[model samples]
Target: MLKNRFNIAASLLAIILSVGFIGAPIGPNNGDPTGGRPTNGRPTDDGPNPKQTIALGDRREIFADRFLIREMKGARLVMHPPRDEGPVMHFDQPWESNAPAYITILKDGDTYRAYYRGGHQRANGKKEDNTCYAESRDGIHWEKPNLGLIEANGSKNNNIILEESPLTHNFTPFLDNNPSAPQNQRFKAIGGTNKTGLLPFASANGKDWKKMQEKAVINEGLLDSQNVAFWSESEQMYVCYFRTWTGGNDRGYRSVSRATSPDFLHWSKPVEMTFGDRPYEHIYTQQTSPYFRAPHIYVAIGSRFVPHRQIATLDQLNELKVDPGQHKGLSEPFLMTSRGGNVYDRTFMEAFIRPAMGLNHWSARTNYPSLNIVPVGDGEMSLYVNQDYAQPTGHLRRYSMRLDGFSSINAPYEGGAVKTKTLTFTGKALEINYSTSAIGEVRIALQDENGKDLPGFSLLDSEQLVGNEVARTVTWNGKTDLSAWAGKPVQLHIYLKDADLYSIRFK
Candidate 1:
């Protein structure tokens, strides 16, 4: 169990509230004039209603705002390789670090099924093509089942998925933003890519798998048929967004190629969607198109340099522009900053997000320019991500909020308590200005008018600590999709019982 145990500090005794000062510019001729254009009827329009107002400090404050530190208590890297104790799997040798692709979860009555790719670097010059499976009763804790499934290497490849040679085709197994796909409902993952050509394969039960076709999906064509499919009911197709490079240049054309099938077989032709800077995006780079899953949107992970790794939804993807280089309504894309760690190759193999913790506690990563999102977990919904600082070794870490004291408009900073005052918010996102000496867990909570807990509102992402509270700001990314806490009086509550919290501001 990956647990975070800490001690609580003594409770504060008194509560205080203080008013935030905002400055309004005093116009001329209101009382004592400086530039009061000699008006006739005793000064016109009350001196133009003061020009602007400046904020002295925060206009509003959150009281009793606690952070609920839900540590990924039992969620650890299930398939991290190069371990000295485990049965040394041949593929995981020279184990610098193992990158994880997508971890999919399936629910069968009371039991749950999981499948994930255990990715490592290509040691001994092996062409990096190995995918495996594991299981758990509760999603958090997992174990490899002794099932005599998937085999490697053969003349035509018998028990293997697919061989990534000049002879066969391979696709990175990246899950499409299809909510209705079997893979989303626990089918096998079959596509995604690395820094090179396409590598594609499929699985039945996620463990016992086989290659779909002996030949590559795209035979030396402009497009590489990587496994980037998403289930679309409107089109009734399993659409895969693939990348096509031309002349081995730094740029390539990106298209959402569709392979339609009633089942996972017997496909249709590819449909192309080119948006953004195709050449720049295709230059040893891979990216996913933007699709709406209601409040949240999904983006794919790839990089031209640094061996192309994974990244989560650090920022909202810009609205897709149908015309490339048109300078339309598209916002600038947010560049993923690599979080440093040593579990994998520092210079290579980065971690990106697959999806939010859904049926199980499985998340994903990539390595060796390899791609594939596998199912993971048995019964948990815990997921952890690392910052891309590109360090090679140490604890794969995440930053969290640290709680401090609170002040109010009615009371001063007597202790850590707040002199209860009602607050109104009319913004989209909330900001938490906090400081931490170290990285740890910090939880936040919210309540309604009747003081009922709002369902499905929690901060599960990494907390990137900037510096001291007075200098840096720790923000809680938008967990709730509502435009703002409008029309509803959402009393903010935070729990730093397990950690520390500074201050919170509603955006």
Candidate 2:
């Protein structure tokens, strides 16, 4: 009887070992019972468990991407369109009657400067294009100053800045913000064709420009569009985003390429930007620049061109006086973002600046945005666009939005919650740019690294935040200061009810 009992026990032990039940149980954290390793087999050194905590030190984070969001219950990220401000200036001059394209506007100190190409064929039968200039005290009211630099229409009384043939076809300029940049090169520009490569020009006062080099500085990629270059404060270098053909040999869809330079003259090898897993589309003009408020994040309001996608009828085209062969393709603006890298995060793949309520807006090349978004008023920023292209009514229009209002974390009346990834910040209080209805409210809770609500900072203790404001300080139980939790790794549990949270910063 004893021998039989021993045999049974031995048989049971053998079965248990065969089923692999001797170790810890499988879990969501890559089967690691301690939750030390992520599913990607990477080991994290911060926080309590599966993921790493981010060190976001007092930088304003916009809801344009999912870089800081960890989880959400019923809230969603939504994109907001700008309000149309109507046409500010028309291409009505004799030299600008044909088409005025590739517009660029920048805020230089107290003054606003604008640059664009004026395309027209002279009476001598010479097809020449000139770079024109305009100025504005405020961004809304513009004046075409008589530059008197280049002669057009048998006189030098127009706002013609430069008449260099191929260069003026698409001359784009930017105000340099590099602290080390010489005063003589305060304003820099890049303009040329694919055949001539890209030529570099510099100016001290932005009205007079001269070539920095006799030869083209950048020779790689197709330099046919409004190639933009600027001093990147975050990257501490000069970066340029230009046009390129994806599949090479000028075959595939239109794309963008980037290159860096320690100085403006010597550039590194160009790297084509990648949009991960998104469907291929022609990106005609990539007006990419760093957001003025958040210099670390780059915003691109690019023109998405769809070839042969005609939307206007023949009657509508004839009524609008659109030029022949330019009505076959349609283009609209789309928004993209990046964090100083070659990968663009196209969160919203839809049209950002849609066509207006007229058939003329549905024509080809009608809504290309300018290169930069500049602050115009308190808590307000504006962007410019070229409208009614290839028509006699070609003009520039302004669009306005609240600062850092590109995208938002929105919730309906029923309410929802968004929990941020673990992070450490440096400021004593939290500020949010948000809007809400009459009955809507927002509440915030502070959670520890382990996801437990900290005492005195739970949702029950948070005061209800109501009304619409661009920068409102968040408080808990009438306490506004958060200096105690400044350097600690914590998570934000944002509860919203019929509200839109545009951006947040620790200040």
Candidate 3:
């Protein structure tokens, strides 16, 4: 049987070669430009079935308009703030006091760990930076435990995890999620100057670091910012996003570049990320990390800097006692989401978390978020930011958002509707993460792949849902059963009024 199959395959290949049918697309989106197509790729009237079978997984689908969406009402991005007006961790230590910045936090088991750059100190006679450490229990309160790992300022009683090298400058480490990664290389990091190139570092416990190799893993343009590299579960490869230049009418812009590596050692040529129709600006520290719950959507709370956008007066600046450079340039954390492919959706060209009302927070480079966002409380995740940069009051502050709450398909008291493209799912019931006003309500309707209303799951049958919940199941006229519809192609028509739908997934 195997021999006969091989013989048939070989005969077909020979026939195709003889007819010169190489590189021909055999199916939809198979590089077949000649296929009957539409802008939205909806099946033409009297054409093929308009259904798309989704893979078997409860993927957190956001309201990014990645697929076909229609009649979405007054939906927009919402900003989140810290629980209180305070910094989670302060730069009070002698070694970290000079200019503590480039913060990265990760949750390991029970304890949450943090790392930041310790700038040069005149009294300590240190000229370069050091990687300092901090830990937290609730992410709201942070402490720099004296690990005694690296000696600094004439003593080892410090939170310095990495020091005495250039790796300390912007050293960012990520928990290597690669199943095949070595036990000794559980945590991997990349940090170096553009001139010297990016060097790879690995650690067994994130405390003890070792160089991956003598050579640099990635060498590219203008990597002075906090360059981030991580293992993508969605893409199943190591992706590195760093700073570079985009030479166009948009010259001298502090842009972001992306590259992928299979082994985290060798990397492809980096390409600059494009924000469709968005104006050019200085995107400093593109803290691009995978959304823990929704790894497919790479969320970036980047520090968008304005080179000369001064918001501080001389007396305000003098009160903060910050460096002169703090008088110029301003920065705030902005929300950017990307579904891989080197494309970012800047749907909300606004600050996700703005600087607070203070003289210290109004300085240049302030409000820069940490390298990672970690899930903290139930249905809440935290994003830490470096505030009052170059000032004596410099500190790492925390901001929290509801899970999958970055953006939403919101509607006013006057109702609006959103219809999804055809998709096949393999789950019994659908659940949503949403919030609504006391009077607001949301209703969901199920339709066939061709937009025909399902018999018992149509709009008239959907029960009016109201309330705020991280997970709420959709019911239709007291009917919660959807087992029969599992593994079938369908569409979701959601009518939202005075509510925001963050995400939806079949369970």
Candidate 2 Cα deviation (angstroms), residue 456: 1.9
Q: Write the per-residue lDDT of candidate 3 for residues 444-467, one digit (tens) a residue.
A: 889887767799887657777889
**lDDT of the candidates, in the order given:** 0.30, 0.83, 0.74
**Could you report the Cα RMSD, in angstroms, for every candidate shown?**
18.2, 11.2, 12.7
Positional deviation of residue 497's Cα in model 2 after best superposition, in angstroms: 0.4
Model 3, C-alpha of 88: deviation from truth (Å): 1.1
What's the TM-score of each model vs. the native?
Answer: 0.35, 0.88, 0.86
Q: In candidate 2, which residue ranges exceed 4 Å CA deviation?
A: 1-50, 122-124, 247-250
In model 3, what is the error at residue 151, expressed in angstroms? 1.4
RMSD in Å for candidate 1, one decimal?
18.2
Task: Give lDDT: candidate 3, residue 155.
Answer: 88
Best by lDDT: 2
Candidate 2 residue-wise lDDT at 429:
94
Clashing pairs in 3: none
Count clashing residue pairs in model 1: 64
Q: Comparing candidate 1 with candidate 2, which one achieves the higher lDDT?
A: 2
Flag the better candidate by TM-score, 1 or 3.
3
